[model samples]
Target: MPVLTAECDPRNIASIALLKKLRFEQTGYAEKNFDYGGIEMCDTAYFELKRKT
Candidate 1:
């Protein structure tokens, strides 16, 4: 089996904690944020979770 990953706002402490609780691991990070609508966030953090085999 493979794994799933996601990118989330680095400023969201609660979301980060929840992902960790869900067995996700920190995988990658981006210092520059993407422009959304008309605003940009601090940064993006990546996470990954391997599927049970």
Candidate 2:
């Protein structure tokens, strides 16, 4: 079986809702440092959907 994966910004409620509506399950989240302006830590939400046989 195969799987589909996606990553979205946790702060974006609309995107999160959209993913849920599409039957995507939230696997986990990760936080990493980003260099936007100077330096910032950002959290990312992970989602995945298993293919139906």
All candidates: CA RMSD in angstroms?
Answer: 1.4, 1.9
Clashing pairs in 1: none
What digit string (tens of lDDT, one per residue) describes model 2 on residues 1-53? 89999988899999999999999999998887433465677788899999999
lDDT score at residue 19, model 1, on the 0-100 scale = 96
Error of 2 at 38 (Å): 4.3
Question: Please, what are the lDDT tens digits per residue for candidate 1 over residues 5-31?
Answer: 988988889999999999999998988
What lDDT is reached at residue 14 by model 1?
A: 95
Cα-lDDT of candidate 1: 0.88
- TM-scores of all predicted structures: 0.82, 0.82
What residue runs in model 1 are displaced by over 4 Å at the alpha carbon? none
